[model samples]
Target: MSLKILITGAAGFIGSNLCEYFVSMGHDVLGLDNLSTGSLSNIEGLRLKDNFNFLKGDIRDIETCRKAVLNRDYVLHQAALGSVPRSINDPITSNDVNVGGFLNMLVACKDAGVKKMVYAASSSTYGDSKALPKVEERIGKPLSPYAITKYVNELYADVFYKTYGLNTIGLRYFNVFGRRQDPNGAYAAVIPLFTKQLMNKQSPTINGDGTYSRDFTYIDNVIQANEKAMLTVHPEAVNSIFNIAYGERTDLKMLVDLLKMSLSKYDKSILNIEVIYGPVREGDVPHSLASIDKAKRILNYQPQFNLRDGLDEAVDWYWSHL
Candidate 1:
């Protein structure tokens, strides 16, 4: 059945994609974004659709949050200031947007009597743990302010459910990358950054000897997780957290080689480009891999695209932008 949904950060990389998916499925989507980090170009393609509505606002404002949540069947809260390095530089802004704003959304949702609230959490919350595949039950210390914010989100989410009986689900995203992930900014993710550099015949930057690994989930996988979480019939799945990642790992070195190989077919200059290695940034994890058994069991979450396919699509998008 089609539902009335409110998607915060709907102009963002993942949020925009979610809007498109839901609109195509004949659902009514109300998208709220302040244009901070999100661009209108990302959602412009959807504004012409009759089922999609766009509202420019910040989640930090409780009134705005309350207004957006009114009569919404489900709330997909994707508005957050991502990136560990950005958080490390300005923790207060990150805290206000990620933690403070998240709290506001939860309270607003509870008051508005929304059916369910599914939010975007981060895998960085599993900081410093050496577990091969991270489970939701086991977590280590938060290494960065960003990780702390995400962990705190889970805490607040649980508390809200316990205190007010608000149905909430947190999907912990790991290294999500794909089309519309901004590649020109200083805070761009490795995949988009590397893709852009390769397309432009420029060197890509790698840190810490290119040995650092990540789960490297795709955009489609994240969207599927969100869709499943929002529509799951199991009562146990509600008011819980799940990892939204493909259960695999890829190191930086391998990623660079893959990007060059893919780009070389169209542009030979990419093959001669060298990746520059530098100091590892603070608050960055060395390796990250997620166990999706819990998500599979609960939400029936299955990732449709792996890293190679995701990278191919990402690079192709960059090629178009260039």
Candidate 2:
């Protein structure tokens, strides 16, 4: 059955992919974006679908949010200021957009009586914990403004679910990277950044001796989690948070090597590129891995792509676009 779906930040990497997935599946998609960090090009491809509609606006405004939420069945809230370094540079903007804007959307959704709300949470919520595989039940103090904003989203979601009977699910994403992830920004993720450099035969920078590790998730896995969270009829699954990541870890050094190897298939010059190391940026977690057992047990979530396969696809995308 096709349903009306409203996606905030629908021009962003993850959000745009979600819009594409739902629109392709025959859902009526209303894509709202301010294009702050997002690009109109992201959703321009979706215009070919008759069921898709695009709205240009910011989530920080209550009226804009209300207009987008009215009569919407499910709201996939993905708008926010991302990047820890960027947050450190400008915490106020981060708080305003990620926290204040998030609250505005929540209020609008509650008022609209939307059936369910699924949002993009972050692994930065795990903060300074030394745990190898982060679990939802245990979380440490947030180290950065970005982390704080994401944690607050989860808290507010819980309160809305309790106070207004609004169903909400938060997916704490961990280094989600794949096609359409922008590579031009100074704060771009390692995969897209490196893929661009390698394709151009330039050395990629490896922050903090390349030992910093992450459970880099593919976009398809996140899309699967969102779809299941929005469509699942299981009552036990509503109003909770799930770690949306593959249960595997890859260090930055290994990731650079893999990128080179993957790109080598298309361009031989990529194999000769050397990785340069730099001091770690402030607010960066040394290591992160996610426990997906909760999502697996409840949402029946299964990750179809791992690091290597995901890297191959991501490199291919940058190769084509760049």
Local distance difference test, per candidate? Answer: 0.92, 0.93
Clashes by residue pair, model 2: none
Candidate 2 lDDT (Cα, whole model)?
A: 0.93
How far off is model 1, as Cα RMSD? 0.9
Per-prediction tally of clashes: 0, 0
Query: Which residue pairs in candidate 1 have backbone atoms (N, alpha carbon, C) closer than 3 angstroms, thus clashing?
Result: none
lDDT of 1 at 279: 93
Over 249-268, each residue of candidate 1 has an lDDT whose tens digit, in order, gives 99999999888877777788
Candidate 2 weakest ten by summed lDDT: 267-276
Misplaced by over 4 Å in model 2 are none
> For candidate 2, what is the TM-score?
0.99
- Cα miss at 50, model 1 (Å)? 0.5
